[model samples]
Target: MYAALTSLHWVYLLFIILIIGVMVLRRDTTLVCIIGIFLLGLIATSSLTTALTGVFSSLIYAITQLLGTILVISIIVSLSHIMTHTGINEVMISPFTRLIKTPNHAFWIIGLLMMVVSFFFWPSPAIALLGVVLLPVALRVGLPALGAAIAMNLFGHGIALSGDYVIQGAPKLTADAAGIPVDQVIQASIPLVIVMGLVTTITAFIFMKRDMKRGILTVTSTDLQHFDEQMNQRKAPLSKGLRLFFAVLIPILLILDVVGMIIFHLQGGDATALIGGTIIFILMAISLTAYKNKGLEKITDYLINGFQFGFKVFGPVIPIAAFFYMGDAGFIDVFGKTLPAHSQGIVNDLGNALAHIAPVNTEVATATLTVVGVITGLDGSGFSGISLAGSIAHLFSATLGEGIATLTALGQLAGIWVGGGTLVPWALIPAAAICNVDAFELARRNLIPVIFGLIVTTIVAMFLV
Candidate 1:
């Protein structure tokens, strides 16, 4: 494995460590990521011009990868703006408000619903679908926006995505890599996933409640007020009948979207596109109903506002996403196969190297698998590195002669928990943007609970192994 690595690999590893350090210090990593991409291009191709060009290419690649998410979020926000302005949002959330009467009720209900939807539809679409409806309810009930974001991130991205039971995509990936039956891996993951999910969410909720009590974090009604102001600015508000009609029609349409996704087997980008397209139609209906002849122009205005907010939120994420993309397939795409012949991409190669460095034992193997999962997940894609986790689990299980299923599940859990979205600012953008909270701040708040969850989960894995 060491023999397979090159100067390019080591340089990439060094930058990964550096970037993690910067992030741990709560510093902006855009500049750092940009420099890392440049240097990696410089090292891989040894051409100054190529290095500079790679920076631009990488950003484009990241944007392309992220474009679907950005578009869905923009459309959702645009629809939300219209809903708020038409006084329809109030009606939409009124039912949920009754059930979610307190902050605690808001957190648990939103989180559990997010997790269930994410299990089938995946987190991106789940966030888009539920965020608009449930978020305002959560906020009105005194759950801060950040807390709402955290619930969606943890349960949707962290737990549902990690286990991936309904879709079985995650389990299949790890199971195949570990050379075991998918059922084995799935069965093995059950306890670990439950432990991880409970520990992390309960811990996060406790911390949030503590902060709220201390007044360090408090609910602000500004978002509701802003929407009220927007509604007042409208020359002619939608009739109460119209508002009630759309409020009823929208949820039914969204539920049908979910049914369409299930019947058509849409997931990920396909699932998100379904939701986005539905939102656009709904947005059109409301805009036309509310503004009459001016509706055509208002449609453009709403879209513009949505896109503006979308790009503004995504602007900072692009550079860092670009840099991380280079660690995987983006390297070959941006640099034209500059990696060494034997390299399994920079991230996978680094993971392999780490696997070789550690000695064999239940404890060592368990710890190493968790660490490798974290390292591979540094690219901010939990799925991108999970195959590596499976491969590494295979290597260790071969040495240990037992616990292959448990190890595979452990690695899968760690990778997805970190890169799936909970701790990755860019990856968690759906939750952050939907909840109208800062992505980085959401990541910061999630850091402790996720870390704690991983530590506890690793110990459990060690014993199970």
Candidate 2:
């Protein structure tokens, strides 16, 4: 009876349904499932008395647990917004535009930089920064906004997220679930991730090259005006000295942060803090240097815009993250103590059920992991479904003989790389919104390259792993 009833975490299953319904039929509002989770979890506790107490308690619990991750994301996003409005971000991008002279260069560079930044910071925030700065230049060099956007989505969200080297998020969780060193998973995934990256990059470029020639293609000014308006404000320009200051200082500071992260060994949220603090200082320096008399007010007002930008980009995802987080053992420890110690949480139960039905052979496990990833990605947010997948991987790693972590990472890659935003209209909306492209069209454009990449990655994983 326990095995039968627990096969589906009723509340979590409800959250999934809630998310799908909201995305397909409802639309507009952010995180309807979170509210549903509160109500549903409350009612599951039994009586009206338990429902009343559990609802508020669960809400608080979810918020408290997710706060650190959320706050770091919010601050980084805020810093990115601050830099953009202040023109410091523009000054920063001015240098990159000088280098990427061709469409191929633009595609690879945008994809590469987004991967590097997003490895440290999550992709959603990083995409806004990359899109605002490098995206236009990519377009100017004859790359379609669709191509640039696709690059951002794939590298930033896919390869970077699967490895999660700096943040070590997916790796750490998988390692913990499998009871292995985080470093072990990291080491194992290096070659597999690189193979996937190469295959995906080549495929995406091939798809994008259909429109642009080897040299350059021209687009109408109206079709591409959004890129220019990125740093344009109706406000006044800066003085020569102030412009010179940002020109000289910003790169030095960013370089210092990069060097420090390497030397001091920053990981997880610490890396985000390092980048966020540096950006704030950069924001301050520019505000003061540009507007000496009004520096304080400008700084304060500018930061508000930054917060808005951060929230606008990531706000919807927080509730979604919160909802999915409930599927993890981390959050369950606190609110779910009512269950017996011997009882399993959502992740374990699902994994145990899977492992029991299907023995953990190499071929079976690899395919299972990849299929799980694809399924998880259906609701979008490739990262959302990973913790659950990680948990399942943990259960099977012991029984599956060799290469469980590799299978796990591959599974995670499929789910997020596709669902997170690369090929999904709902997930791609943010990138599409600022890039001024239609999300559905972008999804259609991305489908072929992305699918080809996935097939290649899956095949490679089977042989190699």
Candidate 3:
């Protein structure tokens, strides 16, 4: 027998379709679009009851799912704040800028710095730190604020986030949905990440160079002024001896943490906490010794701001997440009164439908999931769309069987890599906001890089995963 449909199902379907349209055409915020979806959910679920209770429940459910993603973002942003206040953030980038005097040279260096720091701290913090440090240099050289934002988005959010080698947030979420070890997802994701990273980065560079050649871009004087203001806010310099010591000391310490993980077999959320904690500690030490009396105050202030930024970024996403979270059986444990062990989950059902259709190739499935992710991201919340892709993968992989987790990971990559801010104009807010660029234009510009990246990722997945 087929599963019974509620009027609410049709309503949600329509809501989602319209929301996707708004994202593509109007580029509305995900939360704002979800307001329509939520209203529909209320109308459908209430029917005669006018029961407001169901509406509240759906809202609560969606918000909770985004909490974890938001929490991770919060911690990273908070750490960036601490680093900024402690002056470690600038210290991290100073040596690199000294090495690259021109925008042409600055592109690779900034890209490299954005990639590395983002892998450790994640993208939000990386952008904040880099915006304060390198954005001005790029803008000053006539790189244009839009160009700077694109560069940051490509290397930081697209590359570093896609792989998630250090922070590992994306993999953990994918792994949980698949009932696979995080290591499996991480390892399987490596080749796909490399392929996507190369294709995406190269594509971005070509566009940037073309923009530079046409004289359509200029560096942002605002960024440089912001940098100066923040630098003045610091007011005290670290002793050359102390600065040199922490510079070498912090990298070595983080390296040891990585080594420890491999040797000791740490993975999943444990590893995320370990790496994140270490970064915070290193910043703490630098702050205490360098800032002296101001250390505690400034560092704590940074932490508060970081967490605040994180929460704001992810806040709207939480409700959208609740709806997607319903697609995963793993979440039913926490989300409902009860769910059966043998019950089919939303992701599983969707995947099973795709799997049962024998003519559909793996590449087709991958592409479909990416499209779903791109559509979901329009709601302006990346994490909200994750579970939908995860659910679809779970269903499809059960039929594939050979590398179910990897397929799931592949779908996870597509969902996050795109929805996380590559395509949807609304989701690109952070980079857009910092660069003082138009989020919609940023999204439009990303269409090429992201679509190209997905094409490469799909081909790589067909071979690698």
Candidate 4:
């Protein structure tokens, strides 16, 4: 049952506004988030001691909610490192190089492969897996390094990560915040993801081709030298035969995980566990084989590398996540049942209040969420703001009386497409570095296409909502 709004609810709304304002200015929200959490605890419990402890407690709760995602990502990155060092990744990706005979061939092939691989692992690791092996082939075929970076950024970071169908990390955060099922958000994202991916990538390809014709885009000697240097750095300790065997074996094992997910109907944490388990074993086996007696030491080294990456990526996210989690089920988890009886969480209570005072239409709700998502993404973490989007989507959806999953998916797409790596200069570094292109240039080339795609996708989401 719904209850009337209280100071707790208004305080949450005020902090949400402040967080959005900070994000729009492209500033860090961690301090703002910590203060918000402390204030929320203060208001709910009226105890300075409880409020102080609540900050740490909320972070623990957020981490508990997010640990599965962090672990799976860490494991995948660890496995990627081992595969790269042993030359298994190159062997796996080398066959795709045969498909690139021309510039057009290179763009689509590299993009499609990146998207598919990114779906299972992650865009960052997928970039490493495909970049070194394919960059030379793409360059030989006349595709500019900037063009390759755009393709990878749009396809892998933009498309695969926005949908995140297999990994479900993005959806899990949004869905939990929205008080909806993860599968519902994933299903709702399919059509929007397709539209956004097609429009953005095709528009980018056209612009790239036009630039080439105008002599504005060309393969550079510097890019080739960079690629050569990276290639030279990779000397696999494993024999050619061993590399080939593992390369073939790895894909089959990854495919089996997909098949297992479908057969067992696993989703969310279970699906991630399935993949994480497989990758851990893969890392151990490869480390043992590649290092012989030194295998045990190498496995720890790879995992440490992975955990470092995982924590680095997630560090900025935890505080914001902790603050937003309080809007939903996390409130009671962090601070006891401090609300009045019948309160349906802070976000829902605010939504119910807004519904009674001023009815919200679908168009306004859709546009508001798109703006909020884009603004939140401006902070450059893509993920740092999605939980906020989910909370706001839930609030608005409650007023509309429907379409929570669609709104959540739309917000997820907008935030990730903007900050996940495509439009953000800093976020684009990995693909830009790998392709030997300037990150700012890649972001510039991506701007028009991504904006057009977001506009189209927003309109499509309005209809779906």
- Candidate 3 Cα errors over 4 Å, as ranges: 1-72, 139-144, 218-241, 290-300, 317-346, 349-359, 436-441
Provide the lDDT at 100 for model 1: 95
Per-model TM values vs. the true structure: 0.65, 0.76, 0.78, 0.98
lDDT of 3 by residue, 298-327 (tens): 677766776787667656555544454544
lDDT of 4: 0.92
Predictions in order: lDDT: 0.78, 0.64, 0.65, 0.92
lDDT for 11 (candidate 3): 46
Which clashing pairs does model 2 show?
A: 382-416
Q: In candidate 2, residue 330 scores what lDDT?
A: 36
Query: What is the per-residue lDDT of model 1 for residues 26-104, given as tens digits with 9 covering 90 to 100?
Result: 4556787889899999988889999999999998987886687677667767886777677775665556657998999
Give the clashing pairs for model 4.
none
Q: What shift in Å separates residue 115 of candidate 3 from its native position after superposition?
A: 0.5
- Least well predicted 10-residue stretch by lDDT in candidate 3: 330-339
Candidates arranged by lDDT, highest first: 4, 1, 3, 2
**lDDT accuracy of residue 220 in candidate 4:** 85
